[model samples]
Target chain A: MMRRREARLGWLFISPAFFHLVVFALFPMGYALYLSFFKWHLIKDVRQYVGSSNYAFCLTDETFLHSLWNSAKYSLLSVPFGMALGLAVAILVNQKLRGISIFRTIYYIPAISSGVAIAMLWIYVYLPETGLLNSMALGLLGEHGRLTPMVASMLGKPDWHLASIDFLNSTQWAMIALAFMSGWGGLGPKMVLFLAGLLGIPQSLYEAAELDGAGRWRSFVSVTLPMLAPTTFFVLVTSTIGALQVFTPVYMMTKGGPDESTNVVGYQIYQEAWVTFHTGLAAAESFVLLALIAVVSLAQFRMMKSTLVGYATT
Target chain B: MRRKTWDKVRGALWATGLYALLIALAAFLLAPFVWMVLISVHPWNTPIPAISDLIPRGPDGQVHLDWSNYGLVLFDPNLPVARFLFNSAFVTLTVVVGQTLVSSLAAYGFAKLHFRGRELVFALFLGSMMFAGPVTQIPVYLLLRSLGWLDSYWALVVPGLSSAFSVFLLRQFFMQIPAELDEAARIDGAGDFRIYARVVMPLSKAALATAAAFTFFGVWTDFFNPLIYTNSVEMRTLEVGLSIYKNSYGGSNWPAQMTAAVIVMLPLLVVFLFVQRYFVKGIMLGSIK
Candidate 1:
């Protein structure tokens, strides 16, 4: 009798969350899987049962391929650089120096700010003539900055001007510029996570390393790096997922412009679903993305298995 | 003594290098924010200021502070900045409260109540986290449309009311609380709900606050949902509204755009300043386990 009553109460307690999960998450995911195999138009409301044609269409579609390439490129460029820079800064700010909290706060500000706002801010920062980056580049490589003539001569193009290199306007530099901004924006939270990981390492381990005459560099390589593997693995998986789904920046800043150079998979999915109203195609493309993310995440897990074992033991 | 002096000299060099690197990183991180503030106050109609001019000087060669950009952003007849702010605050608050309540209750069930199929249900909930947002985006939009909740607060709030991540986080925290308290409460004739309400919730304030903060920040900064769902100008959240504002008047009104950005970011920045420790702790807790 008591067990039955407890079971009833448990079910009652969890029903609300279960309802939400079914309504929002589980139902939608199932519906997405169903929709991926059908021909559904947003406006018409008539769903034709098409078997695997949407996936077939996505495979052959050049724009889909390009966007996938773009997303993969972005993940490749942003994830490693963001992790490295974040780890470097975390180590820097993790010191016992005075007022380190202030620096930590400033670094983390961008991560907490709205993505659209950050994109808006970066628009001005990346502005060609009067922007901060170009201005700095010009100062460094202009006629009087001493390196200007050498760079110009090396390029062997008299028209090569540092002031006119529009970071967001050109096809070659647009994706790279977005990657740089992403790296910068993501630095804070990544650093914070690393800082937490650094702090969690038992002080005794470091003391023992020092007692064994392990220098700072050697200890960092053996103790700090191994201990931090779990955090690094977590960051890698999450950031890879995040980078693949990069949308707001592309939407707010470039809108997949400059000859479709910045059209990542996430933005492409949005465009397909909303702009072209190809709901079925969009659903299929998202599945492809899901598959890719799963594959990459699995690869990361396999590669980092040894380090994770270290984490488990100590 | 001589060798110790050399070591001291090396240590001094290391400290100097570290400080220099830190200062440079600080400047890199903060300079853009400082520039945003400076440009927001600069006269909108004038030429873009030179890099050397951190603060713009008027044509009279005197320092002039122009508050017109802020005025334009806040009171522009077409923009509806205040409405967007209200919508964002309303939706964010609802999600924060609703998610915290629902997630905590569910967490309590998972953490304290032992019943049949408990582990299975919890595993299903955890599995839901693996499904990324885009995978479910279209279906949810369609579901909301069918419910006739499009372009309304229902579309924004209802779908986001319960988060798997929040439930997971709260469950982790709840499991750490000793079961003896609940057992003691049961001996005192308190029911499960009563124990949860009076005992578990009180002890779990930090966890609850952490969940609330994450939900608040996520909902506040979310642009993709608001962009896709809310078509009407009044239904728009601040992030989407600012993006629309940028699209329409960004080129001619750079200062006003910056002002609008500042307005959108100010509330969260203030909230973060007050609960900075909880925010960091939440990140640490969420990431570590």
Candidate 2:
């Protein structure tokens, strides 16, 4: 009787949340999977059964494949460099310096700021002549600045000044620009995580390294890098996942333009669902993304478990 | 003694170099925000000034500043930005409060209550976190559309009212609270609800605040949900509304665009400055495990 009463009260406490879980999370996952096997239109409110075609179409679709490729390129461009910068900054700020928290807070501002606002701000930053980067590249005094002509002459493109490049409008530079911004915005959280990892390292290891006649650089390589393996792996997995799902910057800035150069999978899925209104296609595309993420994360997990953990334990 | 003096000199040099590097990195990270703020104060519809021209100089060559864009962006009749701000504030607050309360209740059940299948249910919640948003967004949107909740606060707040991560976070915290306290409350004729409310909730304020802070930041800066769900101008949240404001103003109106951007970003920065401890704690709590 007492157990029955406890179970009844437990149900009462969890029912509201359980209701939400059923309605929002579990139902949606099942429903999305169910919908992927058919052709559905939101406006027409029609669904037709089609076996395996949605997945098959996604696999063969050039635009979808390109988007997946772009997402991979974006992850490669952003994650490693961002993690490097994050580790560098983490090591820099881990010292017992005065007013260090202020710098930490300042570095973190971009991460917490509104993404759309950041995208808009970056559009201005990447503008041809009036943008911040171009202005700096052009020597900050408009076109008459000395470095523009000098650098242009040195690069054998005497007519081509840095200020003349429109980053978002050029297919070659668009993805790189977006990746750079993402790295900037994502650095803070990665840095903080690395800082935590740094703090967790045993001071005895460094002392032992010094006793073995290791210098600062040698100690960093032999001791610090090995100790940071797990943290590095964790950051790597999370940042890669984040880079794959990047949306606002592309949506606001590029709209997958400049010859579909910046059409990431996240934006591609958005276009599929909302713009094209191909609900079934979008569902299938998203499941493909889910599978890709699962595969990548599992691969990384296996790699870490086999190699990094072994190194750390030995 | 000479060697000691040389060591001190080298140490001093190293510290100076480190400080310089830190300051430079800080400036680099902060420059875009500073540029946004400076440009927002420039007069409306003007050509964006060069770096040398950034310091606004009127025709008379006197240093000048324009504050009109703030008024224009906030009170622009066509934009309805103020309404968007209010809508964002309402939805964010409601979701934060509702999610925290519901998560805590469920967390309490998992932490203290003796029930069959408790572990399984909690595990399900944690497992659901791995499901990507894109995989489920379409169905949730369809669900909202079916209920006629799109373009309204219901669509925004209802979908966000329960989070599994928050439940997991609070459950971890609640388990650390001594069970003796609850037992003592039970011995004094307090029911489970009272023990939960009067015992658990008050003691778990730090964890509750951490969960709420994370929720606040996530909801406030959210662009995807607000963008797809809301169709009307007035229904837009600040993040989406800021983008819409930028679109209509056209790219040439840098000053006006920056103003809207600043207005959208400033509140979060301010809130973050004051409550940054909670933010840091919340971030580190999840990752360092």
Candidate 3:
């Protein structure tokens, strides 16, 4: 009776959540799976069995490969750079400096202020004729090109057959531009998480390291790096998951534009569903996406598991 | 070697690290915004202009700010942003109320009620978080369609009433309350609904507030679902309106396009500043665990 009573109470505490989850989330997944094996049209009453054709078609699709590559490039570029910047900011603000909170707030402004209005804003900044980057590039070119003329003069390369090579169109530059956007948008949240982790670290370790005749850089490497590993792991796992699932900027700014150079898996699923109205194909694509996300996340989790568990229980 | 020299060297390096990181991030974050603000004030529709001058100049050759973009978006017959705003508010408000109340009640049942397979059910809820709408949209649409709710307010309202995060958050909060309180109320001959309403509801304000904020943000920021389901401009949300105008402005109207983006963002900005205290407390309490 005692065991039964305890089990009843536990059951009581978990059922409502289970029910809501089942109806809204779990059921949807099952239903989505069932739908993926068939074809459905919006305005027409047509239902045809396609079996695994949709899945097979994705293997041969050029758009799918492009989207997959773009997503891969974004993850490779943004995750590492975002972490570097985040760690640098976190260490800076960890000091007992005056007016540090002001800097913290200023850095946080971009995350909360994400808007569709950025299209016009970024366009001006990247405009070839009068864009801030180009004008700056032109000035730098006169002074001796850092990276400007090589990129601008890339169309003159005898290697590829292209007349005009715009950044959004050039296969080399398109993903990089998107990666920059992700890195910029991601800085604030990652910085805040690192700040929280830094505060949680004991100050005595640093002082003890200093007393042991460790130089500043050496102490940071020996004490701080290992101590902050857990936080870094957490932030990286979450950000990479988010980076892989990126959809908004591509939709708002690129629309898989300049010959689908910025197309990603998320946008591909969107295009399949919205632009082409292939709900079933989209479902299959989404399942593929879900599997991909799960696999990547699991690999990251396993890799980070040893490093992220805090040392000294600190 | 002087201690003073070492101290000065360390401080300079730290400052260098601080300034470089902050400035780079701020430029990245702020550049688009700065560009957006400038474009909103610019006198063209193009993101790029062919003119020799990048900066705005009035006919009198003096630099002057233009306010016509706001007037055009607000007053133009070709666009009805007011309708979109109304649609957005209605959808958000409805979702907030429905998600909060239903999710709360369901959370109470999970946190308090007893039956079979409860743990399995709870496990299922956690598993569900991994699934995004790409899987569910068609099924849900079919469900809504069968009920003849396509392109209607019910289509948007009914499906979102059970936010998984809200239910989970509320369940956690509800679990923290002592079980003896419920036992005492039961001894007083209180019905289950009375026990929930007169007792549990009064104590769960923080969790409910968290649910409200989450629901509000989800609904307000949402565009994809509404865009798919909604057929008419009247029923379309502000984000959709902002998207349509981004392409349809039909001229070098970068400034006006920037104005549109700013206007779409203004409400969330205002709400963020207004309830920032509550939002921070609520979301952190709800999620970080």
C-alpha RMSD values across all candidates: 2.6, 2.4, 5.2
On DockQ, the candidate that comes out on top is: 1
lDDT for residue A176 in candidate 3, whole number 0-100: 79
Query: What lDDT tens digits, residue by residue, belong to model 2 across residues A1-314?
Result: 98999999998888888889989988898999999998998788799999889999999999999999999999999998899999999999998888899888888888888898899899998999779998787773236667656666777876765446799999999999999998889888899889888888999999999999999999999888888888888898888877888898999999997899999999999999998889999999999998898889899989888877678577
What class would a CAPRI assessor give candidate 1's docking?
A: medium
TM-score for each of the candidates:
0.94, 0.94, 0.82
Better of 2 and 3 by DockQ: 2
DockQ of each: 0.72, 0.70, 0.40
**Which residue pairs of candidate 2 clash?**
none
- Candidate 2, which segments miss by more than 4 Å at Cα? A1-11, A140-144, A147-163, B178-192
- Cα lDDT for residue A77, candidate 2: 97
Whole-model alpha-carbon lDDT for candidate 1:
0.88
Docking class of 3: acceptable
Q: Give me the runs in candidate 1 sitting further than 4 Å from their true place.
A: A146-163, A306-314, B1-13
Which digits, one per residue and each the tens of the lDDT, describe model 3 over residues B1-289? 6999999999999788777766775676666666566667766454554234445678888976776778888666887789888988998898888778777776777778775676666666655654454477667777777788888888767777777777777888888889999999989998667888888989887667767866776687676778777888777788777778867874257677778878877777676554444443443334344
